[model samples]
Target: MDARWLILADDLTGAADCAIAFRRRGRAAAVIWGETAWDEEVPVLSYDADSRGLAEAAAAQRHAALLQRFHTAGRRLFKKIDSTLRGHPAAEIAATLAPLRAVHGHAFGILAPAFPGTGRTTVDGRVRVGGRPLEDTEVWRRDHRYETAELGAMLATAGLASRVLPLETVRGAGLAGALAEAASVPDRIAVCDAETDDDLSRIAEAGLAMDAAPFFIGSAGLAHALAASAPPQGLDPVRIGPDGRGALFVVGSMADISRAGARRLVAEGAVLHLPVTPHTLLADADGRAGLAAQVAERLAAGGDVLVEIVLAGEPDMSLGLRLAHALADALASVAGEIGALAATGGETAAALLTRLEIRGIHLADEIEPGVSLGLTLGRFSIPIATKAGAFGDADSLVRIRDRLRKARTEGSLT
Candidate 1:
């Protein structure tokens, strides 16, 4: 009988790792997980198919990487792979791994991560395989809708009914608390929100170090902001209520300010509201519509005065592009004797001056994520910042806020 293989696939790297495990013994291969009905599952294989999209809840570069990693040699490889697991669930996967498995001779298995609410069936609990419990391995995984489908394919091929199981419980401290179930190896953890590239460098950093990490699902506001879809709840950013508006700055997103705790910063008079452009709102289409409108309305209502306490909304691309013209027209065209407009939001903070055609300004408030302060008293020009959404990242929001505070206290705006 073939030995049981519990493949762990989280993101693209997770998938790659699964294939790598069997590379020395079984045929390990990669397959592009194309899109399909959200709740559908198929337990069969046909080599001729598109790659599956590893929906991160995944990022753009990560997907692009998957496309780059899975390089098929030829139809012959597929033909040979198809012969072994002719009627298997993950036969397609088996076929793809045939070449590697042929050399290694170990049964092929897939490892995947469990996504929230996506039906997952796991037969292997936190038990040992030959005195080696699953929990103590170098990696642990879960499955989303797509990986679950692949697993179903595997079970069907092995002539076993689908088994659903939960991953081992993790408990500890800080992020380590999240990894309690796994063996301690100083694993790298990354909050992946594929819509943006903010955390890519870090995620890549974590991924490249393979053996020391098991991906964990953390609630990062930035991840949701950068995701292609607006996450169901808090991931979505909204303009703060009028009562909470402060000196609007630039380079911020809903994720930065959506939290009840983060909102507390505003409620306590730490952050303010700054003017935004229509260009930013339009970039996200409906996503930034309401907030952009609010920013526009505030600026129109004579709020463009020399204020020093507001923050900018998300680094709305459309807003960043157009706000300069709007600000130029407002300042140069309308508000003669214009001095400087305060701002926040990372991308907007950085692009405002160039976009608005202004030369410079000064920084007034100093605040940040960790509460450390920064002051700027000299070269205060158009206060611009690198925003989270500008590069499609969510966690950048926290950094944006922290940077804002630090920038404010560190130097005078220019």
Candidate 2:
């Protein structure tokens, strides 16, 4: 009951996934964003700073300000970064360390950005996705803020000194001592390489045992590790079930993984598939309303509906955010009929939920590695699930749909 956790994520999906990590382990957790009023009584609180699409300096400033505003003496801090090293991770990490140093005399960060279940790992101080170097991955090519994938080099960009704790050190008996020594210098970050959940667990355990507890920095993998190490709080978690309405899916990511998943889900023919084009999203209000009306009609009839953005040929990457927001706008009209909601990508989730006037989500389960199931808070309490753009397999969306369907039929999460 004494352990309070504050997870700061740069995007909505990251916030929900990290918060659900704690929730899965019996802690009361919620994800909030954009001035949302959070319950202080909740043992775990994850805040989406929505800085993933910002410039490096702006992302850093946002993280610094958020940390200063939310960090309390009793609450432990977890900085959630993208597994692929997207956004301004180094700048954000440095920003996080600054305030922690001012508050705790000396602050150190333990960075382990590995989500093995999703094929993201750090080896030889370099990040790899699906056994390929991060820089060689499509995700990095499509969206990246750094020139290299070397953890130490990336951290150095922000003037923070870092040393890589090789997998051997992480698995060795001297890990605790090594971490304590590595973090002895102020503003130092220990970048640990992890290829498995066990390695991450060891790193989490060692960091927690340090003389001066270091702030954690990682994706959902490390969050899961820390959550496993935490003592149970016995708080009642928010549960979600079917509300006798149809499910709504919003897919806004152009990533291949998400695209393929959406295709598979549509191919199954279980839901009414509506493909929306970029031009349609950018068009007049009438076009948008027409799409929303069609979706609402299906939902009103108790039919599952999938609204996906279809990017034909090569798209202008610059318009990704704009298109996501526009898609959210087009779907806003159907929020009231949404019994269960699942959204892919952070931008789409944030924009759509904000439009729905939902202040936050009370996490219920981790449906998949990086997919989170929760209940919306604010205008409605329907079941909602969120996933990062590049976290799941081709069948990920299908699984999410099945989970939501079960929740609806069973009236509770198992």
Candidate 3:
């Protein structure tokens, strides 16, 4: 029987980004969060647990519950964690393994969270972004829950035993045997080092060669390798309607990468750029309506629009959530005029979808490495694309806009 895959992520962008790995390989994949119907024969289902910001205990509990509901003996499980190790990876990994271990008599986790395409690599079980240790990077300094950048240490703090599989061993011919030996130890996780896509492919092959199913943990890099190793399933593309209305782009992240991409879009002059502050969104109803009307008018005239949240002075972390919600509300007011949607951050995408009453999205194709284009399946059915806050380069947003425009014109987006 063909192996069914389950990708459980902490947020919407992570879920869609990973699911597109399977979709690109011609396997049927869909991303859903909250209550939604599922097709048993879809082959791959990526569910967003939406627990990135939750407390450690709460995140673990949420993942455990979702695993209990969706996990089965035959399904190949991939726990999607942030490439930079931002979320509760240690806790979520343990929560995922508990029920599996109970049923299989033993379970081992094979984690490789390196997405080399995006400059994230694991060397000697330590995560590095661009050539710097993850802890020393801006991402970790801004929002990190772990005490260190070492994978083994993080796992140990979560009460889990782990061993690092160095790069030499991973790249050697004895990889499969080494992984088998590692899996022999009950509840022991083997954190493999990978520096490139080929390294990830080797790890995927070795991990899949095991007799019993081992829980796989990684980012889209590993997912792509695993999906490639699976049996061929012909692509099932969805038809995207012609773009007669304007597309909407929402930027809700304060990350430097996201800001750079938005700036590039503005410089390109391909879309109408509108910047709003949290105070304006929260206190100015007339201002919100007026802004929405302007966006709607632009969209109705077949022009693309980009709306970004800009802070006035010093950063106010407390206003992030409120500003996100306000942006979502403003977008919802003009949902009818929107022909397509592209959101940069996970939280921003989730809020926009919820406010628009969209239940789920059927992932169609990937516009770029981390950018996923799909069709909305619920209340607001339109072509949409999503990318993580910190995944792409300055020109990533411009590429997305061009791809969507090309897909719409060619009438073969799916």
Best-matching candidate per TM-score: 2
Displacement of the residue 24 alpha carbon in candidate 2, Å = 1.0
Q: Please give, for residues 278-371, the per-residue lDDT of candidate 3 as tens digits.
A: 8779999988988899899999999999999998665676576678788888778788898888999888998889889998889889988889
Clashes of 2: 1
- The TM-score, computed over Cα atoms with residue i paired to residue i, of candidate 3 is 0.96
Q: lDDT for every model?
A: 0.27, 0.88, 0.88
Compared with the true structure, what per-residue lDDT tens digits does model 2 show for residues 1-414?
246899999999999888887888888888998887778888899999999899889999999999888888778899999998888888998888778877787788899999998899999999999899999988988888788999999998889899889999999988988888887777889999999999999998888877787899999999999998977657554555447789999898878999999889989989999888888999777878889999999988889999888887876778888988888778887888888999999999999899889989888888989999988889988888999989889999999999998888877764
Candidate 1: Cα lDDT at 368: 25
What would the per-residue lDDT of candidate 1 be over residues 1-414, giving only the tens digit for each residue?
111222212222122222222221222222113331111121111111212222222322332333234322221111111101111213333332333333333222212222111111122321221233323321122112222223344335434333222232111122233222222322211212221132322332333233432222211111111121211222111111121121244333223232323333344444434334354333444534444455555545434222212224433333333453344333233222222233332223333433344332111221221111111112332233322221222333344444443333443321
In Å, residue 119's CA in model 2 sits off its true spot by 1.0
Stretches > 4 Å off in candidate 2: 233-242
- lDDT of model 2, residue 262: 89
Ranking by lDDT: 2, 3, 1
Error of 3 at 175 (Å): 1.9
Which pairs clash in the backbone of model 3? none
* lDDT value, residue 68 of candidate 2: 85
